[model samples]
Target chain A: MPTDVIMPALGMAQESGKILRWLKSEGDAVEQGAPIMEIETDKVTVEIEAPASGTLAGLRVPEGADVPVGGVVAVILAPGEKTPPETPAGVEPMVTAQVPPPVQRTSGRGRAGRRPLASPKARRLAAERGVDVAALAGSGPHGAVLATDVESTGRGRDGSTAGVPRTPPRLGAIWQRMAERTTQSWQTAPHFYLSREVDAGRLEAWRASTRKRAGYERVTHTDLLVKLVAAALSEHPHVNAQWHEGGIVAAEEVNVGIAVAVDDGLVVPVVHAADRLELREVTARREELVEAARTGTLRPQDVGGGTFTISNLGMYGVDAFSAVLNGPQAAILAVGRIAERVVAIDGHPEVRSMSIFTVSFDHRVVDGARGARFLGTLADLVEEPAGLVP
Target chain B: MSSPSAVAAQPGTRELTLSQAVNEALAEEMRRDASVFIVGEDVAEAGTPFKVLSGLVEEFGPERVIDSPISEAGISGIGLGAAMTGMRPVVDIMFGDFMTLVMDQLVNQAAKIHYMSGGRLKAPLTIRTTLGATRRSAAQHSQSLHALVAHVPGVKVVLPATPYDAKGLFKAAIREDNPVVVFEDKMMFAVKGPVPEEEYVLPLGVADVKREGEDVTLVATSSMVYVALDAAEQLAADGVSVEIVDPRTLVPLDRETIVASARKTGRAIVIDEGHRSYGVGAELAALIAEDAFYDLDAPVRRMCAMDVPIPFSPVLEDLTVPTADTVAAEARRLVGKE
Candidate 1:
């Protein structure tokens, strides 16, 4: 018997997976459990192994084809088995024709027998919208009337009701997911923002001295804030909780996620148990996570199980900005650029390095007073860097 | 209608193979009711070649789980006679193709006992059988004959696709007053799914929407439910959304759910493992067309096995049935996506 190599379901809601490339070609002898192809899902790219040890035959879909989950992309035949005459019945060919064959209809029929070939939905919509189905040209198979045709009639060109020419931009999977998540968070989560400005004199000093060290040369302000935020979260567990299924559930670990921008969109890779790690270890993990995010090679563990998140746009020269909550998580800390400011101290002018920190909280989980206290603690730690780093 | 997540969301749910689930349902029901007993061929020690009744003989003893000879008609008659009395007898037919031999006892005797008696006497019998093809069991053993019994008036038929449905529907079948026949896909005995630990039963004559969609409705049964689901996923990539409705029970079929889905989608395709002519698909397509005619965009289509015997050759057998590709292609054509 031959074994089918199917496109496995990698996620709960994933519809299809794109085949990146095949490691082995048709008629190649392969061993079971060996990596045969790489597939990219919405979240990660993973290697698919050969289901059976045999000669790989009957390669159905080619690389770059987005095969549906559980669709047979190839087959593995036994050593003495022969390939079937045709592609197996259920295996979908990726490049089928978009248009269907013409239907054979009798001509010379009157309006009584020759009713308009409109779908039931199309007819209903046409009646509702007061559009004539006979005057519209359909793009559906066999040129049958469709709902879109009815909707576009008496409208602007190409179905644009705004009377303006427009073309929708195609987005990658990552960007599409980001758009959906941000919109969902904004609409669903009741957000409340708290902004605080703290003197960044000690934070800048900590980064400078740490960068001068032998192994800490690449440490940035984001790494320092991750360390301080993890400490503050350990003290105030309420802000580290998530709003899940209409209740507040506290996370067990203080895993902090850092938002990093990539070529396509943004990714939040987490650093597990940040409070328990030393500053050097935290710096090393942060650098590794950022590099992985940029290269699109972050593993599953690097992107999941985050209790709190931090998004810092300070490096882009922005003063301050509030961010949407990275949801289920109750709060997110947004950091702005650090600049020199003149302030009155004891009736005299003094120049100090200052940075703004804004925290967005899901009001369902964290109230005003709890969110204010958490930001106050984070600001205090940013001003005084005594034993918090160690 | 139970969604896919409802079973898993239950507390203390555990994964069990379809065989294990059936066995557990039988054991629980036998323990609950003293009058309940199972009778079939090789049921005691052999466990009917699938080991579904492995521990039942030991737990309930051979007297209750009686093993009879290789006689379908004789055992069916005995089960009918026992059911006509006060006892609740469960008759296990090994292969659905052998339903031909026991047709007189099941159709003529068991199905008509209560009705012929004018509700004075009752026949509470549950006939469990296996249905499905492509097992290479040759023409004698591989056949989906649920449509045959469903054609009759008094016999109730059910086809369970998943382990969760199998256990729940089987228990419900045993408790019903009328004669209910359960057709389990022979190829799906090893398939695993979540079954709740708590006691529960799924009422007959209810349908489940396995996957919800907007474009086309694919009404599938038994093994074909998985096929339709696979095709639905593939169609989703081509921008066609396919919804799948599993009619768990054939007789007293859930017409409202199937018609509502067809009315919403405006297109429907019925897929079954039985023969294409006068099969389950024909009945469902006729019902949907009758109820949702104006709501339909295209004629209701039927996808079933070719009107021929199940071939012995693997090559020919693969071509006789409707697969995911065929279903997807048919859906694409119906929704004008092709």
Candidate 2:
């Protein structure tokens, strides 16, 4: 049997693709899964692999021809099978005007009933970006579609709300756990909030000047808080303790869980024994953890044993927010963006760069006074800036 | 594991050797029903070789517990005739190997009397046979041949691993109207286990979960149940909980209990005293595959006795049979716990 190769829809918005070049010519022996041709979609130019191994026999679509996404481009014939006559006389490869958007279909990775096989994150991203995951062939191990495979660039998603609840395609394992855990923490833990504004004028300047210094990449506000929070927890171990049936059980060391938002939900990767690390060390470790979280490769050790947590929406430009307690962690600090604001300094109106910080505590373990003290120390450390430095 | 929550858990419970349990079950059944008679080779005087029916003839008298001639075919024919003539006869095949001599009486007559006679004749006969390996009993005498009878249409095969199961299953077998072949492990005769003093018939076709666990399910038949339980304990120390299900009867095999446990754990290891190919393990593995394929994360595994005949040398004999260590190792491989 001859294997038919169809053009792939590169994005959700892509209805057709233009044939760029055929890597293999007619009558050429083709190995399945090897790059056989290149097609230019509205967004990307990708080399398409052969759907089956055989001799590339028929070239129905020619180069520079625009064909429907699902239109057959060529056929691979078995060794003894007859090939159709070459690109017959003056035949136009142009898709007819009456042709509708190509029906999404995936070869080599077609699941039963055409459901498509994709990883959880990939499924969720495809749904959010309106990509037809069922149309794309999987490229991951065991034919699993990854999140990166959901190309939103040319997916034709107009960013219009469907007038229905805009739910993500899938919650995935990470988000499913997040929903159950956060709800349990909120419903069971007697949560009380603490908010404060700190003068971040000096902290911001220090980070900017440090970036210019030798051997520095980028010093972020989160890096400074990670260091300060670890120091604060060390000074107030009660805040680093877990609430148990017995009572407040203080952790011996500080392992801070930094909440990062991925395609699906918030994943907190722990920086174990953060108090022992200097500012630069904390920055490097935090960056690695964040990258791992984004790539969905955080190991069990990367996320377990969190005694405290930090949720920063500063990069998203949020003014202030309250974070739910993560696991048995007695407290979690929510950091907001720093912007210049007019404030009264020693009874005089003054303009200064300030940032809002809100901290939530499990009243079962951390009392109002202790939580306030921890928050006060953290604010002092961040405002002073020098105290956070190694 | 400690015992069934009630009888298996009762305080002051006395231990009975598996053979003694068999003797007790027989005596109890014979006393309850005058129609329940014993007729087998040397069963009346010698208690056959395992002494499982010892003292039964003295208590029930020679008329009811009649000893039969040496020929297995004649003995089986007489047992089936008595069963068809409104008497429940317990036939003891001296060795599992000798059961072949009585196959015609069992498979063609005893197993099919009711079916062939269209309810006019019912063979309420129970054939008690011995099976095991590593007893230093040579090939012919040490074969576990329950599968042969179990494969026949109307025969119910019972294999009890513990004293508790021995007493209960034997009673159930005596009460059953169809021909039930009870396979008693030769090596298990002297093994002592908790048995309730009260008479209770464990329902045939029911499987007992010797140990409750979550990681993997191990379905063991006959003597392999003990091996599986031991393996479960060893796996427990490594943080792997193995559920051990013992199908007391092979014919009316409790596929539900076995498949349920397999589905719950997503992995199963079947241990049987018979050969690995087309034997008890193969049947059980096929059962799980057909019914619980999607539930499995790995292929169902089987650890069966080596296909070679039962060897006379003690070390070789031990190697011929499935062991606890082998069972645990297979369970680990099945569940990837290793």
TM-score of each: 0.53, 0.53
How many angstroms is the interface RMSD of candidate 1?
1.9
The segments of candidate 2 whose C-alpha lies over 4 angstroms from its true place after superposition are A1-390, B1-12
Report, for all candidates in order, the number of backbone clashes.
Answer: 1, 4
Which residue pairs clash within candidate 2?
A11-A155, A12-A155, A13-A155, A13-A156
Residue A272, candidate 2: C-alpha displacement in angstroms = 50
Displacement of the residue A306 alpha carbon in candidate 2, Å: 47
What is the CAPRI rating of model 2's predicted complex?
A: incorrect
| Residue lDDT tens for model 2, A170-256 | 334456668878999999899999999999988887788777765556667788778778888889988999988968899988999
Locate the minimum summed-lDDT window of 10 residues in model 1 chain A: A104-113
**What is the fnat of model 2 with respect to the true interface contacts?**
0.00
Superposed by TM-score, candidate 1 places the C-alpha of residue A197 at a distance from the truth, in angstroms, of: 80
Candidate 1 lDDT over B1-338, as tens digits, reads 11243245456888888899999999999999988899998888988887888889999998899998899999888888888888888898999998888899989988898889998878889989998889999888888888899998999998998889999999999998878899998988887789998988999999999889999999999988888888987898999988899999998799999999999888999999999999899999999999998788788999998999999998998889989999999999887777
Question: Candidate 2 lDDT, tens digit per residue, B43-106?
Answer: 8788777777888878989898778788889988988988888899888788889999999999
- State in Å the error of residue A140, model 2: 17
